[model samples]
Target: MSETAPTPAPAPKRRSTFLRDLVIIVVAALLASFLVKAYLVRSFWIPSGSMENTLMINDRVLVNELVPKVAPLRRGDVIVFRDPGGWLGPGMGDDLVKRVIGLPGDTVACCDARGRLSVNGHAVDEPYVVLSRGSDRVVRDDFSVTVPAGALWVMGDNRYDSADSRVHGTVPEADVVGRAFVITWPAGRWSVLSRYGDEWDGVPAP
Candidate 1:
């Protein structure tokens, strides 16, 4: 009866791996963040008042890199791009943000009696344009130009103050980095950027 075999040695205890699992999770999260920043979205801060009430100076925005690549651009979509040469002067940054005013082959003009910008001969209701500091006008310049193929005419909500396509000329589509889709910083300023498609509803194709 006392011949019971010696108790088998206690099975070896498995070591806890919480730290290993945690490290793996952290690494994976970081990698995913890096990938998103590199190919899906990126953050940029407003360096000036070009976008105004829409994007104030120092506002942080999230730009979707898929746009104008996976998604075609639309008039009124805010975008970020490299300066198309001579657009930026000394001390100015190479990258800038503006709203699409004209697509390739579209004619863009300013002030249609009612102070509205016109696209393809149709007046657009630009509720976003800010009135000049001391005047009732929104746009300070009166000009017209047809956007060339593979280029886009852009402008700012602060029309009178922005040095945009009006001052520098159309930006090549190739120079666009992405479309800015949202304001992410300054919790009070959080909002989705609008394409203002309705403003272009009456605009005819060019």
Candidate 2:
């Protein structure tokens, strides 16, 4: 009888190895992402009209959480901070984003002679303001107050609708979370949120 051809050796078992490698890759990616989010940047969503016109409801923003940890916050920086006075209400959560108008030991006021806002004796022209219905007829008014030491004066772009420093007074620097760097959602609206340098150019440093 003809000798039967030797059967081919069984193929090496590779499925297990491939699965293990894949799992390792996935785990590594997750760890890397978590570290980045914790120390470099993070995402936040707008929940109310407190910062309207500049930041709309449901807007997704990217925050540089690591910046404040490395450097001190400055005037005119738009920041996200933990809510004080329990303004957000019980169980409503913390964190409110607003523009920095005044820093520690600085004066913050609203409605300059030209219906603009002012900081440290310098008038700030805000083109981002969105006036509320019927309120537009009554031109913006003026008020003056100094920011207490270790605190900040913040406000929403939509002054008529926002409940900010005008309502709650100054916020402490320790409460600040991070500066908003970008609006990352709604693809078509993606853009960097840069500070209005001119507004703060002449204002004295605190």
In order, the Cα lDDT scores of the candidates are 0.88, 0.79
Task: Give model 1's TM-score versus the native structure.
Answer: 0.87
TM-score of 2: 0.81
Give every collision pair in model 2: none
- CA displacement after TM-score superposition, residue 148 of candidate 2 (Å): 1.4
What local lDDT score does residue 159 receive in model 1, on the 0 to 100 scale?
A: 82
Q: Estimate each model's TM-score.
A: 0.87, 0.81
Would you list the clashing residue pairs of candidate 1? Answer: none
Number of backbone-clashing residue pairs for each candidate, in the order shown: 0, 0
What lDDT score is found at residue 65 in candidate 1?
94
Residue 139's lDDT within candidate 1 is 87
